[model samples]
Target: MAEQGAPQRRPSIHDVASHAGVSAATVSKVMQGVATVKPANVQRVFDAVERLGYRMDPLASELRRSKRRIIGAVVPEFESEFFGTVITELERLAEQRGYALVAASSRESEAREKEILARMHDWRVSGVVLAPVRNERSPAAAFMKASGMTGVMIDRVLADNAFDTISADSAAASAEVARALVGNGHRHVLVIGLGEQAATVHARLEGFRAQALALAPDMRIDVILSESDVAPLRASLRDYFGKGERPTAVYSLFLKGTLVALSEFRRRGWHCPNDISLVGFDDAEWMQVTFPAIAAVVQPVRRIATQAMDLLFRRIGGEEGPSRALLEPCKVLMRESVGSPGGGARAGGGDGQ
Candidate 1:
């Protein structure tokens, strides 16, 4: 029913504003879901936008305005529960402060991370929240600095000095868990899935090793590098168990590593807190709902998200100061998975009843 060769006209906020007899700012406010405008005015704006088929130009007109109101979030994985929660909190805070959020995930690859950062730059985002992968830093950091883009590094430290950073006290958190295990009378403990030379991983390993040495000066620690190498981890576990000198407890650095170790332990019919104690970093959703609740050091996901956004906004507002590094303390959640070292300790199960 439409003419095939008709010239198509691109819609603009100005067109909608003209039709609604309002200012461009009013139309922008309406599009952003600002509640300050009266309902009748909002209806008028919506009607004009619908009639004109006005698609939002997030990069050019709306976001790049002189006020600096668009915030970009770059994370490793959007699907992870921790990052998902962070995104939610950041968006909520940004909305309350009359700013918009544009988010992207790097999928744990350095090249992808650079591509996404470039895209966000084209979007003219005033600020960015990044969780970069380790061992790679180049023109991206330079671009962020030279382009005047205020940035905050979340969950990981950046190798370059271009952005403010906010992360948990990894070393202290790991030390606390190790100390807890030692206090429970466990001497021999194994640390699993610490990657090669990552900033966060290294901090955790250092903390764990420090506590282990303080308690038992000559205690032997088995360090497993590749968490994804399930066969090697299983082989190590089997060998340790078979030698009649099994570690009394295991500390996993990541959720995936924790899951793998737990699955292997379960397959062997070994009970937690009785056969061996367990502690993990980063609590997952199912951990709370499972039969045996796992003990963990809970990172302040919401706080980190909110603070990162706030810092970014301040920087965008021309607040000149030295780049800051915020280290949030983690809380240890004691659950049934950890118990006294000696045998005959009752294995505590979750509230599955």
Candidate 2:
């Protein structure tokens, strides 16, 4: 007695059972491929399901099967080679351990990250791995803690101290690089792209300034915050390079700022290490192939990814332990970007002439 042109709702298991002349319980058993259902009835239920377009919910089915098999990975940016490598390694490890990884990018926005976490929660993911934003805490972090969801943090740590963290030794690494530059006879050095209060950046700045000042008491150390943009950095570098009091060497804290500094130098036809020595954090694939390869502090991406997955799995298994803090060393790659005080070869280039 339904209206002829009325829209129809998709069928459910009850509709399948009614059409197949079986109980709802029988339909469910057959749909689940239980051995107790008669072969003929199973076939009939399957036919009814196909006809009605009835589909089983994956999360519900997974729960019924009692499998803790899904984990979520949230990162700030997917376009960066660094995060891409982390995701790739995590996925491979997850698959090896009979688990699946559902990865999402926060795009460096708190609201977007919160929504992604909600979606992952709806999917009944067993655990989560996150690289929180540099300055702000993610809403998802508190939610995950409240919901009893297991999680591990990579790269930046959340301010709440609710989740385990695995990060590179930013402070120590930056200090070593500063020492290297100072050891090479560079007196005045500049560090770029870190905010004054950013934990990672602050640590690096502390180390760099401490070491530079320790080596030469009269050292002039300058720190420039990038404000997350390249134009200001380019302008600053250009102005500094044009000035007669430019730092003997420049150390860029982030990849984007590093690239901007390199491009600005190249555009102005200034040679690296010769005119002004440069060093940057994070190594990229093309770094070694550039005109003059850039020196970098490289973090072990694969190892960090693997350890994060392991911690996430253990937490999902209801293992109770203190929050973990891991610090991996950064390997410094020596290239043509660093040299002595008078420049490696172009010392007498006459101050941006």
Candidate 3:
């Protein structure tokens, strides 16, 4: 147990050189049988290396002899649990496979995303996993194609049928959540979130609307396109709810959008599952801890990332052919958020508020 707490890595050539008070090149010369290395300096280097139990990083040396082994990944957001977990897991896998990861958050900007791709290309990264800014033929894709780096797209794909792609089965997940809401007696539903931007968002909205309308043909579904800045969201929420009958249920399409909805509900002094029901598309840890413990569609973040990494590795290994796509399903976490249209929290359950 005590040993477990100690540093796991063996001492490196640099460490040995530092201990011997010599240059790394001097130590390298000693290791490579350079006769010009003074016997005394060589002896000191050997002594330091033995004392520290140092070993050469063979993979690092070999990769230098071959090519850059760094994999670049760019995501739209980082503070969210989903992207954070997926990127961290990919980094772990990359390190295990003797490759390095250089990750960046594009913050959902096309310009920033393109810049990241350009920088990664200049650095000659072995591959890249990109969560693009839009679902279209982008300058970023053109950059990747011209650079010839094995690229695997993640989260929202920018182009379909042209490259390896991996993402959550958002359409299925949306349909599932829509069914849950409709079945729970939510007749008038308000769909608000940042889902009007990309292909992933469009698919989710289409799936939810289709399934929900099929379930209850008479059900009403309204939408308010949300901006990242909460001020616009607040204005939209106030404008929509002020003029019309309050929605029986509010469905937030993204994690950040869910937060905006929660804040608006609080500002209005509204109680969930009492006067209005709430359901969000993306799950968050705090979502389960908050008042009414909001129900959400839980994305298979780890599975999607694993599949993406697998595809990226295949692409890096020179797998040639048509693009591949893996669509994994998301699950629903039914908490105390949704209930009947006019009724409060269900019997036997404490209102989270």
| TM-score versus the correct structure, for each prediction | 0.75, 0.75, 0.80
Better of 2 and 3 by TM-score: 3
Q: Write the residue-wise lDDT of candidate 3 on 1-353 in tens digits.
A: 55867877767778988999999998876644345667699679878876886655656655654446678999888988888998998886565444678999988787888899999988877778888866645567777877776788877763466678887888888888788778778878998867377778787888899999999999899988754455687688888777865888888878877888778777888888887888887888898888788888888888888787767766665567798877877877767877887787655443222
Q: Alpha carbon lDDT of residue 74, candidate 2?
A: 93
Worst lDDT run of 10 residues, candidate 1, spans: 344-353
Put the candidates in TM-score order, highest first.
3, 2, 1
Off by over 4 Å in 2: 1-61, 65-68, 135-137, 158-161, 194-197, 239-245, 345-353
Best by lDDT: 3
Candidate 1 vs candidate 2, TM-score winner: 2
Per residue, candidate 2 scores C-alpha lDDT tens digits across 218-246 of: 88887778654568778877787678556
Pairs in clash, predicted candidate 3: none
lDDT accuracy of residue 232 in candidate 2? 77
User: What local distance difference test score does each model get?
Assistant: 0.74, 0.74, 0.77
- Please state every model's RMSD to the true fold in angstroms: 7.6, 11.7, 10.1
The alpha-carbon lDDT assigned to residue 11 of candidate 3 equals 73
